[model samples]
Target: MSAQKVAVITGSGDGLGKGIAKRLAKDGFAIVLSDINPDTLKATAAEFQADGVNVASFQGNVAKREDQFALVQHAVDTFGRVDVFVNNAGIEDVMALEDVTEADFDRVFDVNVKSVLFGTQAAAAQMKKQGGGSVYKIINACSIAGHESYDLLGVYCASKHAVRSLTVTAAKELAKHQITVNAYCPGVAATKMWDRIDAEMGKYMNTQPGEAFEKFSAGILMGRPQVPEDVAALVHYLASEDSDYMTGQALLIDGGMVFR
Candidate 1:
């Protein structure tokens, strides 16, 4: 068994997921990066290898339960044990409630909600099998919408809400196994995902590109749009021993966007 901790981050090919993987690698964990995009996954793995980080890459859609299980298995096969598993793969749906179709609802929920549930199940099972004395963590990627609803994002918000609920339930169920499940809800980060949201909102609001992003970002109490590093810092805490006593909580790390 390797002495270094191991963390598996899904959707880590880019954006916030990639940022989290980098931070964990810097924290001395052997990283297992998983993503549905093969090219992006391979590129990210190469980047980490160049940086001399102990890393592995797996390409899979986390929305599938079997794929989630395989991801955990890959982590264990590559690195000895899985200390932290991040359910960070999610999709954004920007459309009015009435405009949402059944496919849209299913696509969003399957990736955002179902992935978290099964990912936690797989990680918790592995953690339990690893036995006692080790503190295992299942950190989920939630959003500010999880705590509050937003226009044109009803289904996405609902999916995040489901993620929060699963986080709490998994925490309780896995407590006896020394596995802590918690979630981090981030606000308006300057990522490619936000770029897409901005574009969609532009069409809905009849505004130019970047206008919607500016408007949404202006509401941030911190007076600045969120950066990936900010969210990564919170995830780092949750992955560390410092947050061992904390679980069953959907923490809002949105720079004062949503209170409580």
Candidate 2:
């Protein structure tokens, strides 16, 4: 077993997940990157390697329970132990509530909710097996939508709400094992996911591309759009010893979007 700590971040091929992985790597944790997209995952692993990061990459669908388990196993196989597991893989559905079909509900919930639940289970089991004094962290990726619902993102919001619930329940259950489960909720961000949201929302709102994103950004009290670093900073805190006493909380890192 290696001496350095290990962290497994799902959907780390791009965007916020990638940023979090980089930040943790800089903090001296060996990183295991997982993504459903093989190309992006390979590229990201290469980039991290070039940057002198102790990294491994796994390609898997996070929505599957088996895949989530396999991701944790990969971390253990490559590194010594898993100290932090971030369930950061999620999908956003941009559609009116009336147009949300069963398929849409399943698609959103499977990736956003099911993945977090099973991912925490897998990480906690490994942490229990290790049985050291070290704190094991399970950080989930939630959204401001989890707190307040928007018009076209009802299903996505519901899925994130489920994430928050899972974080709280898992924290309560895993406290005995020294595993802390918490979530970071981000608002409007300058990422490819938000680009898609902006484009899809344009279709409904009858606005041009980038217009919807501008409108959403306008609501941010910080007077600036969110960056991946903003979210990564929060995740870094949750993963570090500084947040050892914090759990069961879905913290909003959205720059004053939802004030709850």
Candidate 3:
């Protein structure tokens, strides 16, 4: 094995994924940044390049099986090995249960649930081939919603709940191969996802802008809304040897918002 590690992060064009990519880069991992958006992908690559990070970008949709496999292949081809895989690409929907369209439900679940399943499947193959065990890690992007259901986010919550299930199941099954699987559940962050959540909630509940976001943030025992870095810090630990003993655990990093 080479002294340098390689990490592939999905939805890494912006927001939390970008944060994890940067953190892993700082940890001395050559990174493969994957996203569906080409422009953001280029921009993020430029940002990392400016910072002198070992990074590359892959434009792909995580919901597609071929893209998921190609992402892992890209990392191996570029960096020579895959050390970490972060399933962070996800989408959210804000609607009453009765109002959710079939299309909306599928879109949410496809990215949040199916992506994790296939992404992990493809990455695990590489890890197993690379001589598995503590040599590689699989990290899922779970959420506070995964632990506690929220109103108007029924489909999104359920999808994340599925993530929790996959995290545990994958951890148990992959342990024999020496590959550890875990998840970090993040609270509301000021990312575009939360902005959309807040905006949609405002339209649904007839509230002013930022009102919905504030209401949720106020509930956090941490006294502030979470940042991408907060979530990335936990993920960094999970990706490193420090968390090798921990597996199949969906950890809550929501600042005491949800006690689990």
Per-prediction TM-score to the true structure, in the order listed: 0.99, 0.99, 0.98
Question: Candidate 1 residues 1-260, lDDT tens each?
Answer: 77889999999999999999999999999999999999999999999999999999999988899999999999889888999999999999899988999999999999999999889988988888887598899999999999999998899999999999888888888898889999999999999999999999887899999999998888888999888889999999999999999999888887777998
lDDT for model 2, please.
0.94
Instruction: List RMSD in Å for every model shown.
Output: 0.7, 0.7, 1.0
- Colliding residue pairs in candidate 2: none
Encode model 2's per-residue lDDT on 60-137: one tens digit a residue: 999899999999999999897999999999999999999989998999999999999889989998999998788889
lDDT of each: 0.93, 0.94, 0.92
Better lDDT candidate (2, 3): 2
**TM-score of candidate 2 relative to the true fold:** 0.99
TM-score of 3: 0.98
Error of 2 at 246 (Å): 0.6
Please provide, for model 3 over 45-129, each residue's C-alpha lDDT reduced to its tens digit, 9 standing for 90 to 100. Answer: 9999999998888999899999999999988888878889999999999999999999999999999999999999999999999
The residue pairs found clashing in candidate 1 are none
Q: lDDT score, residue 172, model 1? A: 84
